[model samples]
Target chain A: MEITDIGGVLCNGIKEGKYGLGLVRVRGSIAGVFTQNKIRAAPVIVCEENIRDGVVEGVIVNSGNANAYTGEQGMRDAREMCRIAANLLGCEERRVAVASTGVIGRKLDMEWIRKKAPEVYSGLGNSVENAERFGRAIVTTDRFVKKAYSEKARIAAVAKGAGMIAPNMATMLCFAFTSAKFDSGELYDMLRRAADKTFNRLTVDGDTSTNDTVLLISTGKERVERDVFEEELCSVFYSIAKQMARDGEGATKVFEVRVDGARNDEDANLIARAVASSLLVKTAIFGCDPNWGRIIAAAGYSGADVDERITLSLSDGRDEVFLIDSGRPLGNEERARVLMEKAEELVIRLRLEKGNGKGFAIGCDLTYDYVKLNAEYTT
Target chain B: MEITDIGGVLCNGIKEGKYGLGLVRVRGSIAGVFTQNKIRAAPVIVCEENIRDGVVEGVIVNSGNANAYTGEQGMRDAREMCRIAANLLGCEERRVAVASTGVIGRKLDMEWIRKKAPEVYSGLGNSVENAERFGRAIVTTDRFVKKAYSEKARIAAVAKGAGMIAPNMATMLCFAFTSAKFDSGELYDMLRRAADKTFNRLTVDGDTSTNDTVLLISTGKERVERDVFEEELCSVFYSIAKQMARDGEGATKVFEVRVDGARNDEDANLIARAVASSLLVKTAIFGCDPNWGRIIAAAGYSGADVDERITLSLSDGRDEVFLIDSGRPLGNEERARVLMEKAEELVIRLRLEKGNGKGFAIGCDLTYDYVKLNAEYTT
Candidate 1:
């Protein structure tokens, strides 16, 4: 599969004979979000620079080794990646940002990429198969290819993320390219909002990876209005982000926990995150146990300012719901059973009695498979 | 079978007949520490007061509902519990403390406790059998009786905690009564310090409960010196605490993760916790995969300052130790076989190149039984 088939994107994978492997995925305009880690990677630095500049040409990604925690050598390699991609595309290096993911502390295999760049540049195509292939190539541990397309705007997005998800930002490495023409400023705003609403709202195992990145690019092939293009682009990106959350390693069911009527959005987010990231709560969901006590208990201690009189409703993706309020469980067993047996996905709703702050977080069930994948990873 | 059998401790379980159940277990003079939670329960307030007064003649614990989040009413209940015990023991209420664990929000069932206070007082005894009953009466969801004794100092402690355990705290309810006699102040300080090294180092599921309490009482029957008593008491508590971590719902094995050579103790603790609480890491341990990648990966992202070029060793409680470093496994087939041959307790040692930071955290292997337990909990 190749990214070029996704309407307006072009991608090339290079075996930089020495530096390992390199990939260039481009779109004339782009929208993106970076990690919130205090000690961020090189790609985040470049992405922020491009977004702040109000113009972005494309993103260059490399795998096999992460150029992180290596002092100045890391920074130099990031700049070099941008420079190489820029020279080939006839654009400013700053407009061509870079991202890398792999083992940390290792230097880039620059000699390898330096030799393979030209061959990769000559090979670009547009097809769904190609897009899927690009998606698979970008992944580290992801089991499925994550791609979403919106026919109305002729935009498509492909993401790579298998694990390292949490409440704040998913520890992911994603490259999304689209052909829709849109203003760079609008694209940046749309990306940020979409990320806050999607990628930032997921918790896989509460471990935030140090090398997480999400980059969106526009090829400007459609040349649509900025607002129209952005709407479609955000929709596509949202779909991809949700898919990433759903396809989290060992995840069996996707959960959307909505917390409302809190003292503030931060409080709501904390409460939601508490429930989403709780191993007990997640395991219960996986077991199909309607353990409302665990859910309420998590919310109660989430450090959020909530009143005891707050109302809570939990559902297993259906009309059936369980209520807990005033520190007691309410409703009959049949209703609870119906809710528990209803759906594979669960939705938990909480209405705090403190204020009107609201928030939503997405999560997945914790299963033995999750343990299997993570526990023996190196073995 | 009882906490009293461990050594020397007097206990009474009071049911008021309507709202709550009350208990009073006393040590002659044993050490105690306080909770870190700023918003503490009323019982915690009483415990602190008694500790400060340099006398811990009695502890009054209640279940059926936590006397928390109730403002003044909660305080009254706590004080009343102490007063009732104090009057019975011929001591000041200031010397009698209180603890509560159960449903949050509802006021203490004062009426029920008041009605059954006489019966509870009548049942108080100095025998080990009474102590065991005290342990059982204080429990909520624990599957087995948790009691520990160290013959070196004739010190014994019993605890009831099956869930809601983390680094910070949990719905953990523990009461340790000993025959060794020490001043109240000394007992309090030693107990506090021992707890910091023991119970505080264990985590069941990483969820901190709002109403967690641990109390130590001395019956003054055995006159052990402060040093010897502290050593034995701490050793006993650590054993029980380790048991608590091992007996966590669905937990298969207890893991003692020792992380040394970090920037500080806090840093070590953070890294150890990150590795111990990781579902993937725990699961890998269950499968005996010796997956060093997951361990190192979790450490890399544990929000701690760590140097990747550090030493790693795994000990399976026998004559086998495996070494891994720089992202590679270095153990031989015999060691690997030993790690996989047994289902006994395991210890993981991680050495970082940061400063001097030492941390220890206890965890359990993730297994299918955990899934089954949690899945069937609410159903």
Candidate 2:
């Protein structure tokens, strides 16, 4: 399978910078996931309504206006966007999914989109340049484009997000295409399972957005084993998730928390997410202070079954330093400090002597640049 | 009630700096609340065990080390502190409580405490200067002392905290004295209710500590109506809570979110806490941007039953500007910006079309200084 075509063009009445429209032209069975946030964007609502039959021809996405909380007019604008895309692609409107990201409580510039939709459609092609353009067009505060390709399964994935990120689909937009044959049900199940382990285990600032959407489309050009396809799908998703964490607004390093030996998968996931979402732990990591107490405290308050007999270690992928050995302080500050200082990606490994469950999460350090970027975000 | 005696002394063998000991001497019934974090500090454990009998003579506290995760030795150290205080104050060992704050995963400097405890005990006296000293000694990163008094009900309170603050008691240490006559059970009930409304409704960085403790001691020197006593207690707690929010590390403004017309009390509180705890909302406030979308999105994801018909307004306790009315955008950015710029205390009032439940929460804006203070806290 392969991507048929992709294109991106400025569509918010701006010639350059911060706002644009992107289009992906591909015919396949589709499986999608949207934000669980109560206040969903207009595009998310329309897409949910249109994707009921699990068939899709293309996706239309925009940046600089979320088109959320804009009442009935917002809903109409979302439908009109799908209509324009459908007319251009010669597909049913219901087969054209739409997504938006950016400032909430605003209406889409429909006139600008109506004029630029044809341009984006005309430029569609299966090229690295087109993929990069689509990735760049969908970003608001993201520092760079995020794209991952799995040659073994012939899958390509692109994601865009920087802030307002948390579990249950962060403020992000992801579109993936594959050539392997798979029904909508199989695709949905595989996508959900992969996302639960990747995108759903990421937190940047502990803020879930109103317009998060992820779509997986299969072109059915080739067939592969189910296990092979699933493994490759997860690989692509993991790559994009790590990129999102590394590029978190104002982030200098990626922080990963892995929890093992919990009573159940739920408990393990809870503990891992708590550590990754903790602001104190993030700041401590940013300072390279090796403050294990913050990590333990976060686990304690995670509403999971935790006890004193837990071991914790710090790792920089090459070396590991144990800070706590089964509730006993090792006082290995020197080694821990050295590891934190030298590690580009910091890993906090917690082993609880409870059961046989494991989970992990990825996050980024809290820094002054995060405050600066977010403070001036909409001003 | 009056503060019979209060004193503070440097306890880390330092003449002056960020480490000290504080003492409060009184003799009456006492009620206390400790952190809900599963990893309790040694002092918190000792205090919980000692306060079971609802009797107290005095309190001993230090701020150089949290005395947490020290195992058996930490417990022994906490008891020894209470024993020392009891011996000096001529009371039973079980009648004295102990508390510690500052760096965690460290042993208490028992030798220094044993030496400095006498100085603090000798200097104990009821005076504004003594209260100020007590306030100063317990602070780690706080820029100012936090104190509140109720004249009509004869209640006085002092709190010290700057970071690692969240609901169910922050990393703060608060001690309140009252002359009104009340049983331990009544006092406990009153303290819990008042604290639930005040201290428990505050969030700075959403990081609850393992060493938070709040004690309310009664001298039983005066008889007052229960209603009046409870009112004064709540007022004093409110004042101290607001102070803590204002003094939050690197904070420039106090942000309050009040939610009304929720489906129930729990929903209202969840919504308020969600808005107050959103880093995005806090950063937007720091930049003085009238971005109501963040507030609305926070409420939407608060695990509450919210809809589009909610009304939202911004106020500085003087003029009010409505940003959303009955699901419609009012576009009152200019007025909202003026209010936010001029207001030291920013209030976000949200009215839902669901029910009659109401609740509120207090928080501080996320700023560069906050990141600086916390990142370099233990380093």
Candidate 3:
């Protein structure tokens, strides 16, 4: 499941050393950052140091057990993972970043990694098959593998995330390697901006995980301009984010709530996110009620600088629109029919008189399937 | 359903000329205001002007039809109801306040008013039958009548609001007449404060009605200090708010989420409300999962200054404590069992290591019954 539309690549293979997919080892010049949660995994410490110098060669990732909250033993296992990966790849242990995503509060099996790391390294390749395996290896409750690749700057990227997602961070993990050239500082800034527009705009169950991370490594095989790389990387990041939104738990329709004419960009985001996450609005969308009252009511109580006199337009991804002025629906029967007939996407526009500000957010309708999926998830 | 606790002198009668419920029409002085929504109602306009000059004697209330959104014809009907009451009470029409609560967008029939006013005035008396009838007459979708009386102040307050509630100005129509002797200015202040803390704290499906109003009438019978009257009035109002929350559609348990030590009061409220209103947390409560993770996650993403290292505690009331600290559950199995057994009322404590600020919010569990209630509401 590679997003070939984006020019990125992913690879996964088994290791014969102590640091296999299920073992412990941090190897490769791959820089990464962990979620800012206080209860971070030991792998996050290793990943943070590797990125401190603003450069990395590769990443070592494993699943089946997340070495988080395991006390001092967790740290020792993480260090041992780095030693094995570094020795095999002929790189210093400090340059290699490590990441693990699985059940928490468990220590890694270092002996298995020491035996499997060599075989996994030997199998690594820059082919589509490896990319698929990498996507599958990082998954936990995900229904499908998520990977995207783009060729705009001759760059490659891939990611895996599904549930327990919310704003600012997601519960899953992602790793992207690109051939384009860029410094570590530039990559960090670009990743933050892209994430703000992408991962930060999503909410599956509004839960942020303790072991969430994204590691971006530059192979430096191609020397692309800094500006072009940033732009293309942002585009690719947004594309993957859209895919994540589409794959939201039991989601059928992906709704993009775009709020304009707010007091500021932050205000717009606040108002838009409130509407997107409102249960009334989501359920109404599921029932196809076209209940404009719920929509206006959500905006009014969003704690945003909203004036009742703001003009509103509700469109269904088309020319059909319902215009609301001064908190009352305007127009005749033809307009109502048009709004009802249009399908696929619902676009609500709010023009506030306060200031020239805007907000964009992504969401999905709340179907009965969504309730069923989450209610019986563990069972 | 008469709330006999907040005892007030009882009087119920039919008014042909005023349409209905026109038993008590005291004509001397009055003060009143209307909702700011542009969709003006006929009664709102008539009452807005008559209540000026800090004097109102006669009040004409009609049920079965709300004279709202009927344009000029509705305004005329509201004035005519007041005119009949004023003429019968031998007072200036300007001293008469009019109120109409029922279905929206329907014009009132003046012929019914021409015959009902004198009959109602003739039957005015302080009796339990009238008080019960008054409570019953004001209802719309409520399963039972609600009326309250306070024996300490010889003041009684009765309200009618069951559906389409969620308050900014107030929730539905509440006409509370007190016998306490207080100045008009003092009464206005007390009413405003009580309305803010009580009606404003509740949310029923988060829907704000177009015809919500709360009017406090002082009969000037019992002389008391202004401060004492304010306290009594607030207590009475809080009782009404609690009933509304308990009677909320499909709510199984009432929960109070308190977030303390936040950076500011606004941030605390944001986090507390976020956790209280989270569908995931509510559903978990319904399932009795004792899942504190969802509650903390909701606070984290509530756009508040959340320190994940902060302390958290869950209780099945005030005494039976369950999870304390972050993710570590109680080692005592007996304590966990005791907590799980008592699930009538739950409280979640989210302590952030910021400034000394706190917020309190109340909500109910989300169940399949709740979904059924809302999903099939209009249908």
Give me the candidate number with maximum lDDT: 2
The lDDT-based order of candidates, best leading, equals 2, 1, 3
* DockQ-based CAPRI category assigned to the predicted complex of candidate 3: incorrect
Against the native complex, each candidate's DockQ, computed on alpha carbons, is 0.27, 0.54, 0.17
The second chain of candidate 1 has a TM-score of 0.85
TM-score per candidate, chains pooled: 0.78, 0.95, 0.76
Tens digit of per-residue lDDT, candidate 2, span B1-379: 2243312211111224767888877777889988877788999999989988988887888886899878899999999999998998898999988889887788888898899888888887666567667777787777776788888888878778775233322378888888788989999999999988898888422345888899998878788899999999999999988999998778899978999999998899989988888778888899888898888888888889988888999999888999999899888988898888889998999999899999999988889988897789763
**Reference-based TM-score, model 1:** 0.78
Q: Choose 1 or 2, whichever is better by DockQ.
A: 2
Which has the better DockQ: candidate 1, or candidate 3?
1
Model 2 C-alpha lDDT versus the unseen true structure? 0.81
lDDT of 2 by residue, A260-359 (tens): 9988878888899888877888888889889888888888778778877889999988899999999999989888998888888988999998899898
Q: Against the correct fold, how does model 3 do in TM-score?
A: 0.76
**Native contacts, share recovered per candidate:** 0.35, 0.59, 0.05
- Categorize the docking of model 2: medium
Candidate 2 colliding pairs: A1-A179, B1-B179
DockQ of 1: 0.27
Candidate 2 chain A: minimum summed lDDT over ten consecutive residues — where?
A6-15
| lDDT preference between candidates 2 and 3, better one | 2
